[model samples]
Target chain A: MMRITRDSLLSGNANRRSWMALVNPSASELTQAAATLDIPESFLRKRLEGEASRPLIKQERLISLQFQVPMPKKGGTGQFMLVPLSLYFVPGYFVTLSEQEIPFLSQLIDPQKPRKRWELVLRIIAEVTRNYLPTARSVAREMAVVERDLRQAQRHDVVYRGLDINDRLLTLDLGLLQLEYVVSEIGHFLPAEDAVLAEIHEDTRIELSQVRDQVDSDQATINELLESYAYVVHNNVNHLFKFMAALIILATIPLFIPGAVAMNVPLGNFPHWHYGFTVVTGGLVLVEMLTAWVFYRKGWLRLD
Target chain B: MGCQFYDTVEDVWVATERYTADGLFLLMPEQVHQCPQLEAALQRCLEQRLYCQDAEITLRLPVALLAQDAQFGTVGRMTHLTLHHTPRSLAILGEEPLIRRLQQNWLGELRHTSMGELLQRVLLSIIYSHERVARVLVERLQVLRMALKTAMGNTELRQIVALNRDLGELVIALRETGLILRNALRATPGESPVYPLLDAALREQRRIEDGVNLIHERYLAVTNAYNGIVQNNAHTVMKVMTVWLALLMMPIAFIMPWHMMTPLPLEHWHYLWFGLLAYVFGVTLLFARWARKHGFFSM
Candidate 1:
């Protein structure tokens, strides 16, 4: 893929260089492309290696930055990863090289209306920053879903719904933090002279700010969901415990009455009847049912 | 090489780990023959009969693996066999290759499933809790998008459209995250197959989708109630305006001077203007207060 870089630009000439359509280049192609543009080989190579490329030294005439972008894959959880590339721009021409095709840039720099070098670069960054909005929105959406699950988890007999919501919120929180970091980098690139790029940069900054706000809003909602779930579970457990305690108290009430009758000193002279135990047992059963009915009507024992 | 095995008798999931192994060992339980998906795969394998007559049963592996086999040449050696006794874990492992292949083949499918599941859960949660009305409103935006197509029109429709685009973009991000998760899942091994967990995950996703639909219904119901209230308010406003206009005409009638010719007082005109203005002002203040309390002005 790097094979097409310098030669492709040279053969087409500077005026006719149709660099718009060149995306999805291989690692070697990116290396070759970087070579053609007089870019440092390591700069381009580092970008493609992984999503978490640490901030490092500036290669001459080029500044490489790596940031995470959320990707949703099937049978997989969402993740933020670095997209590698080296960018080398002079007054006349500019070049970008990446192992995998970045669709956002490709859309912006179409053949019919090719963007200027600086604008292209800034727009690429701007678009990437804009991505935070959608990412935040997605997180918010997922969080909402998680929240819903937590609420209804009990209905489905799944007490683990809270865990799911917690997990989803955690993931979103991490993504939002990474998004903030990426947006802050755009601020570093804002220059006084390039007012246009500066404006674009500012717009992106606001977008990042909005994303943060959304994330904060989402965090609050998650917290509330957790609290509400906790309260419900706690209240339910408390009610059940109270009912159990009530049952014990009610059962002991009749036992106390029998003890009182049997231990009475004045009644010790009377002879025991054959049906006494049966009568006492029946009376206890009836009293227990009556007590249960009264408690149930008073809303002490909830079926749920 | 380090090899370890643990049995989870309580959960019916077995876990085994082996280092320095090049191939996977599949020990299908007798119960596997009962599963339709497994049965089909088994039947295909038996029909192909790739192995010589040494064994009575043969299992058909995926064609991509067959191509791989063709490239590498026949089953040469038993590199690894880390036995696991848990059915749940085994089932999950069985589905691993399928999940991986699906993830690779259709990123959109993966993204949609994950996103769709999430949206569903959010909606379900809001359905039970009256306190989360605002979130329910916000979440409805996604359901509306799924209901409507790409080019939904009008103000409400446009908002929904914008929301849908937002969801699509969000799904893309989630898809990226999903890829990372896939990698993590691949890296992590367990006593049980990951497939049962995945199955449950998918089920949970479906449950969430169901919840979203319910939320959508609830949202529409709430919107309908608002629309009805607006309509009733419009009717009330028309009635009030008509009454005011008729009352104003009474001043015109009074000015005709049928009874006013006897003693036309300047105080009457001042009182009339002041009263009319005060009444209008009072009505305006009341309207403003009502709108403010209901959050109409904020919108």
Candidate 2:
């Protein structure tokens, strides 16, 4: 709900403690921002596009991080976006740059709960980790819903929804994989040379590792259930195939008898007789009945 | 040769090979030291000429023949290995090969020969109250793989797939290990598929067969049921269609020849005969079709 513009982020009010900035940077602005900051142009470009950033890299006292933050719970589609955040710790000041507004900063800047910048980053990562479980559960529930629709044979709408669910599941799986990959990269920065930094980094490492593990576990569970559902879909397709095949084979039987009769292989001059045509017709009727009865017994037809 | 049984553990059969210098004693776990019965059984294997010749040097001899008192705890279960001894080195060459060949040949006769042999061996070790029996079984990895295969999957198809993959791994591992064991023993004491291992192989084979049967039955029943339902519906449809055509076509026959005969025998009558007949035939045909469509007499 909070929409922060570029003007708000650059607002020159020293007194204001907290603010939200939505920075929908155009391609040129992003390029210019990278030029002014002297960072690689790809840094901002990459994060802005993907669901999550690849990993954090530190060069020349500047740390650039990419994160895939989950949208709000009520956010339609439950998608996450890739946002690249770069931090500069140049002696006098610190700066955060992102293509979009960062919500975590607002929580840190809240008047009642003032937090140091270092504490805020840890808090942000922790909150992101905790939120993954619920988001994953929602995806699982969505899959179950699709599975139920399949069971009910609701092919009309669910065919599309099933496709959507499959796509969503792929998206979620990729997002989690990227998140874990980034966390593992960040983990390498731990065992800090400085004591305080080490303590903080180690604790964060454990938290992130646990989150990575939990997400991986959930990913596996979702995949297994999806495989089972795949089998169900396969079974349904086979059922439909059997039905169609039976119908085709059944309908073909009547055609064969008519074809033989039309061949006009003489049946004792019955065709020339006045009402002898009735006998031929009667024979045709008898043939159809007998063929149908055989078909019925052979289980090509179902009265039940 | 006479068979001598040194019944140490209740379910276990132990044979001790005789040493020419002094009788060799098979060392058991420390817990058995407390059980006077197992101690007495160990003495019986040494005293009676019951030990196989190859068993003499291979059996782990105690710290001292008299045995000092020590508290012992075990890391895991123990698998009882048969040891053989011979009076001379020549006796060994002849006896060991015969023992090896006998064990190897017996495997072919055993009704089942997969993990059943391994399971039976493990179970026997457990029933004999051998220490580290579970660990010994676990070390093989094949048993655990087979157990996991059986443990998972609810539906017959899923279970069959799971079990097949597991059993495939198990069989491959066993074959590879058997080759490794044979190569290792070719230089020394030698190896064979003894009775116990053969028994376990049979047990696992049975499990595989059961899984296969379950999957077959499940597939057959579902297909049969589905076919029955579809067939019955089609028969009812065909019967009604046949009856419909017969009723509808009956009226066209009665009017066809009567109209044609009356108009013939004159030049105009010749054309009129064919033409009138055709007109009546067309009208009758249309009426019959309409009746058939409305189901006036169909079925």
Candidate 3:
């Protein structure tokens, strides 16, 4: 599933030159893009495969930038997955290659709008930085859900949910940190001559820093919630064990008297004397009542 | 064809199907074909409307368009809307008052702002509308949680289920809208005035999303608690029934023995019936005590 789309710089017909966006490119498509854009096939391949040794901005014959963007995966557990996107700045046009369809890229480079090559590049970086906000926001929401669930009940399912959210928050935090560093590096790579690029870099830096702050705050919140949930679950289990022990102690007290009476153990006066059944039964009744009253007053007989 | 005009003093544009005594009339959707620019703007507006039904600003260079719909009144609501912005000229389409409000609230206040800034304000307003609804839902969730703590009937459970459904829908809608807005903000220039506002709005939207998700979690918890309460109630009923059965059967242990003719020892006694009565009473009392001690009557 690969798509190559050509977007024009402006809407008018006179100066409608096209830039290429390759979505989920195949090997042959990558080679074609490399040949047409005069970029090295290896550079294109490495970026698509996300095999870059480090985030870099190189200007040999053609300018190239390798950065990562967080892509969402479809699942209930809410995970943060990052994918690398490589950009090649060819003469009179720009090319973007990614293993997956980056929807925000298409939005940034609208065919109907007129944008310079540098403007498009800057927009792409800005958009990629903003993309983290939504995913981070989602993770925060999932954390809140887990926190609420823990408040309602300390069940294993809820505990697992808290752990799951914690994992997500950690993944998001790592991604955001890496992105912040990449963005900073990109800012330094921009030429000092272009004031527009400099301004864009500053704005992007600010936005990225804000995003990092938000991620850190959310991570802190999720960590706190998970710790509290663990403590609550442990306390609940201890209480349950104590309640069961009390129940066992109270239940065993009556079994002894009943067993002795049924076995016909002749202690004082049994069936050999008149009213023997009455005297024996009455004595057992008094003992049972007194034991129960004592246990009740001591709070061991409480069911709730 | 109706008369169309712009209020130069108020900087408001009016478009209507019929000539009005006070306002002006602009070109309808069908009449703007001659000017290719206006036609293109209308086409873009229509495309945006396909996804977002409310007010939106779609900026295409050489022209920027604003479309809004106002749903007023209670039953059979009447909607009046207008679309316009300042670029080459004030090209206003649709109703007048909607355009005026857009001018005074968004465009006029943000005159020095970039298109991205104006668009961000619009998007934030839309997102905040959902936030308000989410706040109400969170409050309702708290009420439901309180109710479930004591007793949860079928009605309350049904309400929780309904609320869950609503929250699911709300979350989906908000997420989709948020994604769209984020993409839009990204496409704009980084130096756009909306950048800071975008950060704040995104933060607010995140908070709302968190609130909704929390409510949903609480709803599930309350439901599970309700089921536990029901099961506990059933167990209590069974426990009481078992105690009663034990009490009723206690006398049968002694009564069955007396039916035998071999019981001749106590038969000659004068107070044999009284002794049997006392024995039965003592055994019943003992059985009750044992039952009580075992938590049969604890609840």
Q: What are the per-model DockQ values?
A: 0.01, 0.01, 0.01
TM-score of predicted model 1? 0.40
Interface RMSD of each: 34.4, 15.6, 11.1
Model 3, span A227-297: residue lDDT tens: 45655544443343344445444444444544454454444544355565555556656775786688678
Give fnat for candidates 1, 2 and onward, in order.
0.00, 0.00, 0.00
List residue ranges in candidate 2 displaced over 4 A. A1-22, A25-54, A59-61, A72-80, A92-94, A148-241, A244-266, A269-304, B1-299
* Cα lDDT tens digits for candidate 2, B1-299: 21212232342324543322222223223333443533443444445313323322211111100112132111221122333332211111112333333234221222222333322332222222211222222232223222332232323233333333333333333333333223323423434334323333333333323323332222222322222223322332443454444433433433333322122224256576576666656765775576455332322
lDDT of each candidate versus the true structure: 0.40, 0.39, 0.54
> Could you tell me every candidate's TM-score relative to the true structure?
0.40, 0.38, 0.46
DockQ of 1: 0.01
lDDT for B263 in candidate 3 is 21
Candidate 1: stretches off by over 4 Å: A1-34, A51-59, A75-101, A143-195, A223-228, A248-278, B1-299
Query: Best by lDDT, which number?
Result: 3
Docking tier of model 2: it is: incorrect
Per-residue lDDT for B125-209 in model 3, tens only?
Answer: 4454454455555456546534543442455556556656655666666665556446545654566444555554555455455
